[model samples]
Target chain A: MTSTDTTTAGKETSKPTPQMEGTTKEFYDFCQKKELRFQCCSNCKQWRHVPRLMCAECGSWEWQWLRSSGRGKVFTWTVVERPMHPDFVEDVPYAPVVIELEEGVRMVSWLSNCDPHEITRGMPVEVEFDAVSEQLTLPKFKRRNNPL
Target chain B: MSALQNEACIVGIGQTPFLRGTDDDCSSSLRVELQACEAAIKDAGLSNKDIDGILPFYGLSIAEDLAVNLGVRDLAYQATSHVGGAGPGASVANAANAVVAGLANYVIIPGGWYGYSGRRVRQIVVQDVNAMSGGKTARDFYFPFGLTAPVQWFSFIARLHMMEFGTKPEHLGAVAVAQRKHAQLNPNALLRDKPLDMAGYLASPMISDPYRMFDCSLEADGGCAFVVTTKERARDLAQTPINILGIAQGQPFPADDILTREDPFHLGVTDAAPRAFGMAGIEAKDVDFAEIYDPFTFQVIQQLEEIGFCERGSGGDFVADGGIELGGKLPVNTHGGLLSEAHVLGMNHYIEAVQQLRGNAGERQVKDAEIGIVTGFGDFGDGAIAVLGR
Candidate 1:
C-alpha cells in the first residue's frame, strides 16, 4: 500500500489510496504511465469505465484498453464544505466534478485550475495527470479554453 | 395484475426509540434488532414459532442469527436485500412475494444499526466503499477525489437539477421545513422538538453545496421491523391489515455510476413508479400520502418527480406552497421521514405508511387517507416502491 502523509498545524493526516488489485490495478497502472484509458469491448466497440472484465452492452469478455482524449465537459459538480475524511480537512471547500468525456464515459475527478464557484454545467475541461505519490498518478482536470 | 398484488399485507410494526445517544440496555445492533423483532411478533399476536421467514438488510444482521435468537424454527424463506436504504421497502416486496408463493406463511423484515453510538455512515463507507453493490467503481474512481459521502455523490444530481430545471435552494428548504413540521407531531422523532422554518433551514451550515445540515437526515441509533402475512390470515391478526396493493424495485441503467447515466436526473424510482402503480391498478393521483425515503432534502424532490407525483422539473414547485405538508394535496413523510425522524434505513417509512393506512397516525395523519405510497432509494439511485391501502 502506498500512503502520503501531510502535516497541518502539527497534526498528521494520511491520504486515502485505492487498492491496486484486479481490473482496478490495470487502470491505475495506465494512469501511472500518464495515459488515461478505459476498457473498450473488442466485440462491440463500446467503451466502459472503472475497468470491468466484460462489456455490459454486448456481454463479451473480449476487450482491450484504449486511451482517452481526456477532453470533456463538466456534467455536474459539488463543493464539499465539510471534509468526510481527515486527510481532506485542509482541502475543505474543494470541488469534485463529474466530467462527461468526448468518448461518452464519465468519471469523478477534481478541477486542478478552476475555482469551485466558477464551475458551471457543460463547461469544457481536459484531464491533467498528477503524480501524488511514487506509485500513484491521478487524472485531474483543468478548464479548457474552447470546446473541441 | 400480479398474484402478489393485494395478496399480502403488513400486519404489525415495531421500533426502538429513536435516539441520538446510545442505550446501554440495547448496545449491540443485534440486540436492538431482536427487541424490534420481538415487539413486532407480539404486535402481530404471533409467537416466534409462527414466523417462518426472514428478510434482513444486507450486512446488518443474518437471518440465521435473527431466527435463532427469536427461537424461530423451521425457517423456510430467507433472503437479504442489498439496496442500501432501499433494503427495508424492497424487502416488503420480497416478503409479499414469499407469502403469496407459499414459501413462507409469515415473514419478518428488520433493519437496525448503531449509526450514532458506534461507527457513523461515513466511517463505514470510508472503511469499504465496495460494501455497496456495484460500489467498486466508487472506490477506484470516486473516493480518490474526496467524494466519499452520499451527500457529496447526490449533490451532483442536485446541482444538475438546479441547472436544468431552475430548482432553487429555497425549494430544497421546503422539504426540510415540511418534514420538521410533521416531526413535531411524532413523539418518536429525533428532531420533533427542533421545529424549523425556511429561514432556519437556510441558516443551517452547509455540509455540501446546495445541501445544508438541515438538508441531511438525522444519524440515529435504533432499529425497526414489520411483519408480513397473507391477507386472508391478516384478518385474524391484532391490527388492521395494510394491504400491499403494489410493489416494485428497480435500478438505474448503469446502476453503479451516476454520472454516466443517459439522463442525469433519472433515478431508479423513474423505472419503478410506473410498474408499482400498474400493479396496484391505480395512478399517482390516487395516493393520499407518500412516505418517501428521504436521506436528503433534494432526494425527496427527485423522488417526487420520478414517482410521477409531479411532472419532471416541477417537483420543486410542487413541494413549495404547502404542497407536501399535512392537509396538502399530498401529505408526505407524515412520521417526519428520515429527515426529521431517525433514520432506520427507511424502515420507519414502512411503519409510518402502515400507521397512516390504518388511521392510527394521530395529529399528522392525512384525513381520509385510504391509500398511500412508500419509496426507498439507495446505492447510486437504486429504488423500490410499495403501494399500501386499507
Candidate 2:
C-alpha cells in the first residue's frame, strides 16, 4: 500500500521506442533500417508487443507489419532505487512502468524525462528511445498529454 | 495400516557440513547425503549395508541422483514424493507405510541440494521429455500479470492476509528473531551469535510487499538423510528410539477449477490435521512441542489457524505469546529452523522432532517432553503432519 509515484517532471516524451533484436528476418531488416513495425494480425488486424507466434484471440498465425502510433498510459509501476543489473546502477530511482497502450497491450518499459516522484498509476504516456549500446536502443516512456 | 495410526519411528538421521559453497552439481550434495547415511547408520548402531528401501523428493533432489551417488548396489523399493517442502513429512510417511506393509525392513530417505552453492537453479533444468513449459490454471491465467517467482506468488497472499487481519510486519519479524535466537545457542548454526533485532529487521531489504530478505529460506548446499527401520530393529540397534504415532497429508485443488476451496480455514492444514489427530488419538493441545516448518512467516500462521490451534485469522496473536520460543508451552525449532538455521529441505526439522522426544536436544531441550508434532508444507499445496512420541 506504500506504493507511490517517484517521477516529478511529468513531461511529454515524443518518439518511437526501439525494439529488441529483430523478431523475424523481415522485422530485423526493418529495425536495422530504423523503421518501426509490428505484426498486424490479418484475422484480428491488431499489433502486439512481445511478438508472439500466433494471435492470442483468433489463434491466427497470419500477420504483417503495421506501424504503430507508439502511445500509451501507465497501468501500474514500481519505483526501484536498487538496480539488480550492474548496468542499471546509474539509473537509480528509475520507474519501471507497466503501460497499457491505446491498442490494448501492456509493456514494462522504463519511464524517463521525469523524476520518480511524479509517476502514478494511470498517467498518460508516450514512447521514447535511449541509446544503450552501439547496436541497441532502449525503449523508454514518459508522461504524454492529450491535445484537444 | 490402521487407517491413520502406525507404530513407526525414525531410527537414524544424517546431515552434511553447513558450507557456504561446494563443488559438484546436485549430485555432489547427494553424495554428501550418502556419507551422512553411512554415519547415521553407525549412530543408530546398525550396519550401513542394511538399507533396503528409498524415498526421495522433488525439486533439485532426485532419488536416482542419490542412488547413483550412494552407489546403491541394489534398491529393493524406491519412490519420490511431490510437495516440494512436503518432502520430509510425505517421504517419511511413505517410508513408514513401506515398513508397516512389510515391503521393507530398512528404508533410506535422502534430500539435499547445492542450496547455497551459488548454483543457478532455473539454469540447472533437466531435459524435459514432455517439453512442457509454462503455468497451469490460475497461474497460467495470471502469467501475463507478472507473477512468476514464489516471492511474487506469495505477495498476493501476504497482502490479503494483512488486509483481512491486523497483522504487522513486526509480528512476522518476531519469527526471525525467535528462530535466530535459537540458532545463537546451536554450535552448527550458520548465524550463531549473530541474532537480529527490530532495527535489523527494519533495515533488511524488502523482497516483496510484505516479506523482507529475512522472510525467505536459504537456498544452499547441504544433505539430509534418514534411516527408517522397524521399531523392533530400532530398539535392538539404538538406545533411544522415538516413536512415530501418526501421519497425514493434504493437497491443493487445481488452480483454475476452484477459487475458494472450502473457505480459507479449510485450506491445506485442515487436510493434514484431522488424519494426524485420528492417527495419534491426540488433540492439538497434546503436542508437547512443535517443529512446524517456517519457509514463510504467514504459512506458520496459516497452519496454526488451519490446525485448530486458534480461531481463524488469530494466528498472529496466538504466536505473539512467545509460544514458539524455547521455554514457551510448545517450543518450536529448538535447532533453529529453515528461517534462522540452514535449510536442508526441512530434514533438519524432522531430526529436531526426534531429538526433542528422545531428550537429546542439549541446551534447547524442552522439559519432560513426551509427544511432539512436526509439519512440512509447501510446493503445490502438499503437506505432511507427523506425531512422534517418547
Candidate 3:
C-alpha cells in the first residue's frame, strides 16, 4: 500500500511485465497478492531470485517459496535518464536500486520514498508493492527506520 | 600446452566505411558482412576457392551463406565464438586452433552491423533484452521494476567502482577525450571531424548517472573482417603477417548475473589476461600497444588494470597525464575504438592491431610496433584476449 504510483511518467508506454510463465508464475502471483517472496533451497538454506527450480549453491531441486521480511539495504543503484525504450520515455530520471535483503539474497527494484539525489549505497530500505496493471504488480523499496 | 601458438597469422584486413548514418536504401547486415568478407578475401590475394574455413564472431556472417554467395565448390570448416562483444578476439584463437588441427588452411573472421541507420526504422543495434540471462535470470526480477539496458547495469558497476577506488567521472572523460584525439588522426573514424573535449564530455546530458553521452560508443553502420592463415602462407600474401602469439577466453562466476558478481569491479580479464600472456610467453610490459574492447570509457581503465598493465585499482592513475596517448606507455585504441570509430563489435580492434603490426597504418600507426594485444569484453562479464606480434 505504501508504493506510490508512477504511471504519469509515460502513458503510451505500459509498465513492463515479468515473464509470468514456468517457475516465475508463483513469484508474480505473490506480487499481485501484495506479498514479497523469494525461492530458498531446502538443503543449504540459500536464498535466490528470478524463481529457479534448482539451487545455485547446493544443486537442490527440493525448494520452497518463502516470504521475505520485506527489508533490505541498498547495495547499488542507477538513476535512469532518457531511457532507451520509447515505452519508458516518460519515466525518465527514475532510480532503480539493487538491494541486498536481510535473508542474504539480492535483487533489483526501484526506490519509492527517497529523492534520487539522496540515494546512497548500503542505505536501509523496506519493500512496497505497486500494482501497475490489473495483472501486474512490482516490488519497490522505500527508506526504512528501525525495524522489528 | 601452447597448442595453437604461432600457428596462424593475420594476413589481410578489410572493412566498409564506418558510416555514422547510412541512407535508407543501404545494404542489409548480411550484405555488409559479405562486402567486408569479399574485401578481406581480395586483400589476402585469395579467392573464393581458397577459403575452406570460416570462423565468425558475434554471428556476423553465416559461413554457409557466404560460401553460397561466393560460389565456393566446397567449404571445409565453419565455426563461431559466443559472448556479445568478446567474440572477435576469441574467434581469432578459434581460427588458429582450426589451422593447427589441419581442419582448414585459410579462415576468415567477419563481423558487421547497420547500427545507426537501422535505428531509424526501429532496428537498434544493441537491444537491452533478458536473453543473456537465459530463460530464467535476475533480469526477470529486475526488468519489471524499470531496471533495464546495459547502461543501467554498468551504472551500477560505475557506482561500485567509485565507492571502491574513489574513481572520478573525470577519469571516464579522460578516456573519451583521448580516444577522440586518436580519432582525429584516423580518416576512417566516424567521429574524426567532430571534436570532443573534456568539458564537452562533462557537459553532455547524462544518459544514466555516471555515464554521459560521450561515455558510450558511437552506434554506426559499418562492417570489418580479417583473414588468417599459416605464417608460411602469410609471408607470400598481400601484406606482412601479424603473428598470433597467444589467445585465451575467460568468464566471471555466475556469468549470467551481473548484480551478483563476486566482486563488482573484478571482471573476466582477471583470468583471461594470465592465460593469454602465458601462452604468448610475454608479460604486460612487453606489449607496445593494445586495442582493448572499449564500448564505454570506464572499461578501458578497468581492462587495463585487470590485464596487469597497471596495479589493480590504479587505472585511474594510469590514464592520467597523456599516458595512454601515442608515445606513452601503452597507446590503446589508436584507431579510435568503438567510442570514436564505429561499433562493429570488436572486429575493428583486431583490424587496428593488424594495421599497426603490418606497418601500413597511415597517420595513426604506432612507431616501431613490435608487439600488441587486443581484448574483447562480452555480455554479463565474459572476456577474451589475444596477443599478437610482428
Candidate 4:
C-alpha cells in the first residue's frame, strides 16, 4: 500500500534528501512504485539490502531486483530524543527500528504507529509505503497483526 | 615477533589547550594543526627538516599542506587514513611501515578540528553526506528515518547489547564515572574541574535512549600530534621512546552498513586486536593498560570486549566493579579518554598511550606500566589497534 499524504511530506523540506544515484537510486525508485525490493544475486541466489552493484558472497555481478516479503522482526531500535536536524525537531522522541526482513537482510526504517517506549526486539512488523515527497517514497513498518 | 615490532617508536607528543570554545579568528583548523605539529617536532628535539613523512587524519588534515607549512626539506612519504576516528591509531601502523621500510626517517601524525566552535561534526556530516566513507547508505537509508547522528546510530547497537546481555544503564554509568574520575587528575582534560558520579550520570539529559549527555564525548576546539620514528632514531631524540610493539586496522564485512553485519557486536577492533597482539608476541593479559576510543560510554565497554580485556559480552560487568579504574584489573582511558577529554579525533588517545609508556603521566599514571594498548573506533565500527611498550 502507498500513501498519498503529500501535504505532510511537503512540509519536511529541511529533511535530508537522498542522493539518488546508481544502485541506491534504483532501490528508492522501487519504493516509489510501492514495491519493497532488495538486490538478489541471479547466479548464487543471495539477497542483499541497500542495493549493491555486485554480490559479496560469490563475487558475481549478475543481480536482479526481487520483491521482499515485507514481513520482518525488529532486530533493534533507538529512541532519538534530540533532533540532529531542524526538520526533525518536531518529531523528537521518534523510534528508528532496524528490521531483519524474512528475506535475510536488514534495513533501517521507522516503526509507524508505535510509541517509542513500546518497541522491543523481535517484535514482528510489516512494511507500508509513504509518499514522502514528489520524488521520494519511504518504506515504513507497522506492527504485524499476527506475529508469527 | 614481527620485523616491525619495536622498530618504530613514538618519540614526541604535543597538543593544543583543549577548549570548549575559541575566538572567531582562532578557529582555523589548519592553524591549530600546524601549531600541534610544530610542538611535536620541537618536543622531539628535531627541526622541520627532520620530518620526512606525514600521515594525517583524512578530511581533517592534509599531508601536503602540513608538509609545506612545517617546512619539511624532503617530504619523502605521505598518506592519509580514511577510517574516520580510527585514522590516528591506524596511522601508527602506517607510520611504522614507513619507518621500518626505510621509506622515511620520521613521520608525524597530526589531527585537529574546531568541532565545537566552527562547523560542528554533525553539521559537517549533514552538509556533505556523500563525503563520509559510508555516506551513500546514510543518505539513502538512515537519513530518511531521522537517524542522522552517531549517537543515534550507535544507540541501536547499545540497545541490542543491553537486550541480549542484560547490560544495565549502571554499567554504562560506571564507564562515565570511572573516566570522569580519571579526568579529574588530568589538567589538560576539559572536564577536569567537573566531577561525574553514577548519580550525576543517571541524572544527565538523554540525547538518545540509553545514551545520556554525559555518556557522549566532548565536542571541543583542539588539536593533538605525535612523532613516529625508528627505535634506533628514538634513542638520540629528546624524550624516552615508547616502542611500537604492534598495530593493526580492520573493517567489518560490510564496513559501510552497521545493521547488515553478521554480528552486530563484532566491530573492526574485533579483527584488529588479535593481529596486533600477535605481531607484538603478547596476549591480552600482558597488557598493562588500555587507551580505548570512547566516543560514547558504551563504546568503551564494547571495545574492551573486542580488544580482549575481558570476556565477550562481559564488559558491562567488567567495568561495574572498578575494573577499568586506575587501580583496577586494567586501567582504561588513563588520560580520561574522549568521554571526558576533548575529542581531537582520537589522536589524544594515542598521545595518552605514549605518555603512560614514558612514565610521564603524573596523577593518573598506571604504576609500573610497561605495556599498553590504544585503539581507534571510526566510521561505522571501523577499528584500529596499537600495542605499545616501554
**After TM-score superposition, what is the CA distance of residue B364 in candidate 4 from its true location, in Å?**
1.0
Consecutive 10-residue window with the lowest summed lDDT within model 4 chain A: A1-10
Q: Candidate 1 has which clashing residue pairs, if any?
A: none
Identify the runs in model 4 with alpha carbons over 4 angstroms from their true place: A1-12, B24-28
lDDT pick, better of 2 and 4: 4
For candidate 4, write residues A20-132 as lDDT tens digits: 77887888899999999999999999999867878899999999899999999999988888887777898988988899999999999998878988987888999999887
CAPRI class assigned to model 3: acceptable
Q: How many Å off is the CA of B76 in candidate 3? A: 1.7
Off by over 4 Å in 1: A1-13, A146-148, B25-27
Highest TM-score scorer: 4
Q: What does candidate 1's lDDT look like per residue over A1-148, in tens digits? A: 2145533344543666777898888888998898989999999999888677788898999988999998999988999999887768989889989998989989999999998988988899998998776666889999998766
Ranking by DockQ: 1, 4, 3, 2
Candidate 4 docking quality: incorrect, acceptable, medium or high? medium
Fnat of the models, one by one? 0.72, 0.00, 0.65, 0.85
lDDT of 3 by residue, A1-148 (tens): 0122335334333445555677777887898899999888999998887566788788999887899998999998888876865556777778888898998778888888888878988899999998776666788888986755
Give the better candidate number (1 or 3) by TM-score: 1
- The DockQ of each candidate is 0.65, 0.05, 0.47, 0.58
DockQ of 4: 0.58
Against the hidden reference, what TM-scores do the models get?
A: 0.96, 0.71, 0.93, 0.97
Candidate 3 lDDT over B165-249, as tens digits, reads 8889888888888888899999989899988888898999998888888889888888888888988777778877889999999
**Local accuracy of candidate 2 as per-residue lDDT tens digits, A50-142:** 556788668999888876566777654545444333334455555555666677655556677667667665688887664433433444676
TM-score of chain A of each: 0.90, 0.72, 0.86, 0.91
Could you give the DockQ of candidate 2? 0.05
